[model samples]
Every structure is written in C-alpha cells, then in structure tokens.
Target: MLASLITFFLIGLVALVVLGVVLAIVGAVFSAVLGLAGFVLFKVVPVVLLGYVIVRFLAPKEKRLAQMERKLLETD
Candidate 1:
C-alpha cells in the first residue's frame, strides 16, 4: 500500500512537471507572436504609409509637368 501511494505521488509530480513545461512553451510562442505583431505595427506599417503618402504627393505634380511638356512640344 505504501509503494502504491509512492507510485501515485510520483505520477502526479510528473504530470505537474509536464503541465508546467507545456505552459512555458505556450507562453514563449505567444510572446514571440506578439513581438512580431508589434514590429509590423510600429515599424513596417509606418514606413509603408509614409511611402504611400510621398507617392501620392508627387504623382499629381508629375502629371501636370508632363502635360505642360506635351503642350510645349505640340506648340513647337
């Protein structure tokens, strides 16, 4: 009976250890995913938006300049 009790205790301890390891792994994965999401939100997204704004700001001026050049050439 004592042996059986000891065996049950060891099994419980092992189960607890396994559960702790699983939780640690899950926590690490969650942390890594959050870090990546934060990097994209803070770093990548702003750069892309800035590039988009710069392009939008320049495009209309470029089209106007192109139209003026065409008119000048046609007059010649």
Candidate 2:
C-alpha cells in the first residue's frame, strides 16, 4: 500500500509539472504576439508617419492641400 501511495504521488507530481510547462508555453506565445503588435505600432508607425510628413511638406502642395492648410490656419 505504501509503494502504491508513493507511485500515485509521483504521478500527480508529474502531471503538475506538465501542466506548468503547458501554461508557460501559452504565456510565451501571447507575450510574443503582444510584443510584435507593440513594435509595429510604436516603431513602424512612427517611421511611416515621419516619411509621409517629410514628403507632404517638401513636395509641391496640390491646390486641395493648400486650401486645407489655409482653412486649418484660419480656424486656429
């Protein structure tokens, strides 16, 4: 009986360890997804916005853009 109890305890311990490993894997995957999303929003978005801003300012303004800027300034 004592040997059976010991075997049972060992099996329970092994199950717990397996569960811990599965949970860890899930957490890691979610964390990686969040990290990628954050990098796209924080790093890539700004780089794209900066490039657009420079192009908009340096290139010749179309009549529409000029009119919008004028309206914005008037509002201010």
Return the top candidate by TM-score: 1
| C-alpha lDDT of candidate 1 relative to the true structure | 0.96
lDDT of 1 by residue, 1-76 (tens): 9999999999999999999999999999999999999999999999999999998777888797898899999999
Candidate 1 lDDT score at position 18: 100
- lDDT per residue as tens, model 2, 6-46: 99999999999999999999999999999999999999999
Error of 1 at 36 (Å): 0.7
RMSD of each: 6.8, 4.6
Model 1 segments beyond 4 Å from truth?
Answer: 61-76
- Minimum summed lDDT over a 10-residue window in model 1 is located at 55-64
Model 1 steric clash total: 0
Tell me how many residue pairs clash in candidate 2. Answer: 0
